[model samples]
Target: MGTSPDRSFFPGSHWLYFSVYLLAFLVGLPLNLLALVIFVGKLRRRPIAVDVLLLNLTVSDLLLLLFLPFRMVEAASGMRWPLPFILCPISGFLFFTTIYLTSLFLTTVSIERFLSVAYPLWYKTRPRLGQAGLVSVVCWLLASAHCSVVYVMEFSGNSSYSQRTIETCYQEFREDQLAVLLPVRLEMAVVLFVVPLLITSYCYSRLVWILGRGASHRHRKRVAGLVGATLLNFLVCFGPFHMSHVMGYILGESPVWRSLVLLLSTLNSCVDPLVYYFSSSGFQADFHELLRRLRGVTAPSQQEGSMELKVQKEGEGQGQDCTVQTV
Candidate 1:
């Protein structure tokens, strides 16, 4: 039997990976958390179909960000897995699952928008919230089933090294491992990434075309921004990572630059909030309100002055003078 191939690393790659992972964790964690809070609030007030989809998307991004520290530590340890081997497959599963989950949710969101625009009467008659929930469930099941391959590949019992002796989490594949993994990677590129991309492209194209005919300029502009951000998330953030899968399968081994491309995938968590901002006006309003409150907290005097001015305006309208009374 052929031995496992040695994985090559670019010089200083670990530090670079560690830096990007840390930045993503720090930035994405708060952004997705805020999005989660906002979506939950919006859902409580009104359970809109698009809000439900965005909520699922927010949760998926949070899962990916929460599990990100494993990769961060692995990178910080010079691309070594110092933790228990059991965690390798678990974290790998969550990481890849959430990546494809993002794609699926984005595609579903586009379809929802397209249907609402293209067939409003039909969309109103449907149980949209229930459908969104069902779609979200299917997305989770499908992604989880596909990503379960991580466990099989990791614990295939044919590793050249013992679990304790393994230096990396998911690197250095043997011939048998490659045989199973490469084909699945190719399949994933098609099913999880490519098909979703094509579907998203079609839905958004039709959405834009339909909106152009009668939607107001501001409304159309927002939709345009939504289309641009969603496509950018897919093509810029996810394109290279999935493309690496295709290239790896063709090359019969993982590409040396696959790790670099994955950095872009990590960035999707941060970019998703932009998609949410464009997808729903409620999200934008809540986000701006949060920012406004934050600013008020930061500048107490300005807040007080604004409050006093409001009182003065009300008092003046009532033909009475208002004074600032300090406690």
Candidate 2:
């Protein structure tokens, strides 16, 4: 059976991991929930394809954030799995599954945007809302199926360690375990990470070129922000984790630094809100409206009548914009 590492490569860094996880949980949870509310509200009024995809992306981020406290607990225990052994695989499955779901949903959103801009006439002819729902379901199934390997490797029956003896949740692969895990990891890296990344890159590049030719400066800037955030998410948050998959396959063991790089992946949950803000004018309008209402609530001395009138006008404006640019 595979053996656990002799010692954590960064013995004193568990606090760092815990701190980052705490911060991400605090920030990502509310943002994603807010995005969820906004998307649901918009969809209830009028269903749009991009909004459907964005809603799924918001849900993916929320799932990742919800399962993150498990990691936080493990980190607080200095990267040890102190909880019941059963919790490890459950949380790990949701954690890894949702991470890849983010990649797929983001790629789907990019494709939707690219098609809307690059082939507006053809895009309109399709039944987009139904298509987006189908795509979302497929992405979830694909990621969940791929990540189920977590359960397989964890319970391979060859491990010498019993539940009480195992120190880590998903680390310390034995030779037999590594033989199966490493190849699967490499395949996941190629299929889930690299392929979606290449597709996103191509779609965004073509998107920029198409918009540059005749789109307004404001439109171009919004697209630029969306593209930049999505790519930055792939490069900064996910790049290192998947690279570790490749490196682990080649080295025949998980790298000592693999745990540290996983923190970057956790950070993606917090970063996805920026993508939501930039990708949808409806989200921006609703977000700003929420802030305005909060301000009004806090400052009761402000003329209630005037504030209500302003909000009404802004809502009307938002409705018009949502009709034109729901994507």
Candidate 3:
């Protein structure tokens, strides 16, 4: 059998990975946090079933963002397990699990949106909120279980750390381990990623065809934005990771692209909020309200300033009237 991929450092690959992950964390965290607050506020106002799933999606993205510092530390230390071995797998587990959960929710949101527009009657009969919540719970469990494999896959047959400070976590595995990991990783990329990509593409395509005929220009624009953002998230974030995994499996060499692709995968947190904002009317309204609140704060200051100016002008006129009377 062919040997496993070369696990050696690719010159500046570590530095590049560290820098990109830091950038992704900086960019993704605040956006996902904003989305999370918006989604939570939305849930309080009214119980739109779709918002539940969108809320879950936002939370998933946030979860992924939470673990980025660990990865950055690993990269900064030249792929060494700088932290405890237990923590290494925990970070790896959360990273993949949450990202995959995001994919699942994105797919679900697309189908939900398409159904509401495409088939209103059938959609009404469906339990939107209940079903969304159930599916989300199920996905969370399955994703957690799937990611549990990270620890097993990483810790087996190799010392968790090297004689030097550097060691692999999820990045590299032994040649003997390749046989088992190859099939599993390939299947996951196909099932978790490729399947969702195809489903969202089809759902959005049909939505365009159906909505195109009757939807107003504004409505169509909204649909297109929603569809485009969803596809772009997968294309830009998950697509590279999916491709790299399969190619690495076949080539038996972990390429430099592996680190880059993984970093890209974390970007879903940064982009998924855009999807939430554009796709849902409630989210947009919430965003608008948040903007209004910010503007409202300044509004009072302006109002107070005007009132102060009017009072000063009236006092000045009274003082002049008194001077004129005295003269």
lDDT score at residue 58, model 1, on the 0-100 scale: 93
lDDT by residue (221-256, candidate 3, tens digit) is: 888888878887899888988887798788875555
Instruction: Count backbone overlaps in model 1.
Output: 0
Give the higher-TM-score candidate: 1 or 2: 2
Q: Ranking by TM-score, best first?
A: 2, 1, 3
Q: Write the per-residue lDDT of candidate 1 for residues 145-167, one digit (tens) a residue.
A: 99999888877885544744567
RMSD to native for every prediction?
A: 7.3, 11.9, 5.2
Q: Which regions of candidate 1 are displaced past 4 Å?
A: 1-10, 125-127, 158-165, 300-327
When sorted by lDDT, best at the front, the candidate numbers are: 2, 1, 3
Candidate 3 regions exceeding 4 Å error are: 1-10, 125-127, 159-166, 295-327
Residue 104 lDDT (model 1): 96
Q: lDDT per model, in order?
A: 0.86, 0.88, 0.79
Q: List the residue pairs that clash in candidate 3.
A: 5-253
The C-alpha local distance difference test score for the whole of candidate 1 amounts to 0.86
